[model samples]
Target: MHTLDQLKQYEKEFIEKGYFVLDLNNMEYVKEASDLLQKHLQKITNNSEITLYNYHAFFEDNDKHYEMQFQMLQFFREQQFAQNIIQSNIDVYQFLLGPDLEIQTEPYLRITRPHKPKDNIGYHRDTFYGTGPGEISSVIPFINLSEKSTLSVVPKSHIIPDRFFKLNQVVNTEVPKDSKRHKMGFLYAPKVMDPEIRNDVIPIPLKRGQALVFMLSIIHGSEENNTDYPRWSTDIRVRNSLTSLNEAMKAGYYKPLKDSATTQTFERLSQ
Candidate 1:
């Protein structure tokens, strides 16, 4: 847990830079989660040698690879992996957000294989996906991330006016036909179409034990992985429970992760 002074400094830095890298206080839970993923991958691939970085080598078919990824996402959510990490790092979250906090129920798993442009996300802000400024996003890498495979963000871009960039809504129509898509509606996210804006985006490298926490409005995305090893990471969104939430998010997309004493009291009294 960080001291009050330290947390205040962190908040100031976050406000100024729009993001910060944090070293997780408890790596035990992180390692446990990583181990669980590795075991599941080995079981599904039937190859003991398969690792997060080299799992792409086992699948030649794009559909099969995506199917594997979808299955892993299901497994990850079913196991409540994000909840464990949040619990372990509750202090930091509370300091960043508030004591009353809600977390996105379905955390996103990003698996970018080397030289796979299709797997990379385009530069965009979460606000384009209906998220509000109250929400913050955290990215946790399962493996060490190099500059070539890390997330890129335009610093201080969160405060930029929306009109400054030409944006386009991009729907992902590449899901494997055989696999059951998790969300029914068109899965889409807005992408920044301006060529000049791309120049400001810079890669943010992170180690296995570090997490990148940033404002949702920041213009950010990953580049095509050019390294030999694949990049694997999971990102979850969190917000103060009292803050405004989009209709979809309020309708059960987000769940309570922590509650203040006042909130708990109100819940009990209402019940």
Candidate 2:
């Protein structure tokens, strides 16, 4: 586990750019997490009655993909394995976010695959469930490589004021696109490339079992996953405990989604 001082150094770097990557190297605990995920996937595939998330169904059939997600959620909720990874993150996150910060597990695991020319969510900020500052997030890459479907982020984009990141003040509706902050990268206009912003856009690659923490207000997007292989990862949001309840209440966010057994499944073709 990282001590307070070491974590602080990362915080400084993150504030300057909105995120930082932590390398677990070959730590036994990290290795255990990876193995645990593999085992969980195997078990979930054996079960039926799961539904896949919209994006996951693209590669595998509906039933089969749904089962894959069930296994993924199992991995997220597995106390033994999830704890090892979560505990390591909490140590550092506490310092970066605050002593009161806690981890909120998402309902599904992500299996991003190579994109066709048309595939992309376009430029956006992750303000789906929160408003204002103090909103932060952490993503753990269960996959084994950095270039494996990595996400692109605009450095320091979180520094933008609340008015820009916030939902509507008039109708109280969420801002569909963060038009004010400016998107700078593939498939969109980049703030870094703009002579006005002067920030450089860089591609961040993460190794297997690495955790990348960043502010939610950061401007970011993913390039098309060019490889033939699919990329698997899980996003765990970490926020000040006080902020969790408020953010979860905003609209579409789930703290620890209420269900357990129900999940998206992928059906295999006949043998």
Provide TM-scores for the models: 0.92, 0.64
lDDT of 2 by residue, 1-271 (tens): 6756677778888879888887653357656665666665545555332222223434355345435445565556655444456665566765665655444543335555555422333335665334335556666666654553676677887777645542322221221243211110112322222222214445578777676777877766554666665556655565654443553453434342111122111112222
lDDT of 1 by residue, 51-128 (tens): 887788886576787778888888888988767887778888899888999888888777888888777766788777
Q: Count clashing pairs, candidate 2.
A: 23
lDDT of 2: 0.53
lDDT of 1 at 47: 85
Q: Model 1: runs farther than 4 Å from truth? A: 170-172, 175-189, 248-250
